[model samples]
Target: MLTGTVKWFNNPKGYGFIQAQEGTENQDVLIHYSVIEMDGFKTLKAGQTVSFDVGQGPKGLIATKVLPDNGQGAKVDNTEVLEKDSSLA
Candidate 1:
């Protein structure tokens, strides 16, 4: 798995970009909410450290699976994730 930090994530959009760790060729990675390996809310925060695998997406490099690193980064309420999704529709 590759380690990286999230650049930013839009909860309502359910997608974000991750900046890969230094020395990696794929610096920018696309991450979707579905790839987040969490039980409740599938989302990531800006600057959050994460471990993920790389895969080819329809557009570009995408995170096949994302796991938050030791629960680090900003905290978000569970309702936020759910609320954002519903708001989009």
Candidate 2:
């Protein structure tokens, strides 16, 4: 898996780009919300660090199975908040 920081994301459109942290040769990878493996609405925030698998798309490189880094916790969805609240009791 390649590690990178989210360059930008369009929450409504469900697409974003990740800037690879490896080297200058590595270009930004396209990330679609569908490819994200989250339980609920998957959305990425700018500057968030993430790890993902690299794949070749028709246009260019793309990211798959994207996950937030250890230091950066995963974004919370409504379901998760409810689950947490229920667990408290």
Candidate 3:
């Protein structure tokens, strides 16, 4: 999960771009307007807290599933263990 601010949105065209908040290689996220608010376009705006998935599109990193983060930050806790003997340490 990554946090970013909406740089710009094209309601008519049905797509937008977001400037990553921090700690990401790709700074911009490509978003399809269909992923925008269903009620109306007003639901989104620049500098809004948006959480999305970074996917590899035809070009590069594109924001696939997007949603408004209600203050609580996204959780990313995937753990992997490597087995080793004490003597190796």
Candidate with the greatest TM-score versus the true structure: 1
TM-scores of the models, in the order given = 0.76, 0.74, 0.63
lDDT of each residue in 42-86, candidate 1, tens digit only: 778898899989887777789888999865334676687698899
* Candidate that would win on lDDT: 1
Question: What is the C-alpha lDDT profile of model 2 across 21-77, one tens digit per residue?
Answer: 984267889999888866666788889898899888898888867987653334655
User: Where's the lowest-lDDT run of ten residues in candidate 2?
Assistant: 68-77
Candidate 3 lDDT over 9-83, as tens digits, reads 765576778888775575577888665433434345566678777777887678776776653322323232233
Weakest lDDT window of 10 consecutive positions for candidate 1: 70-79
User: Comparing candidate 1 with candidate 2, which one achieves the higher TM-score?
Assistant: 1
lDDT of 1: 0.83
Candidate with the larger TM-score of 1 and 3:
1
Extract clashing residue pairs from model 1. none
Clashes of each: 0, 0, 0
Candidate 3 total steric clashes: 0
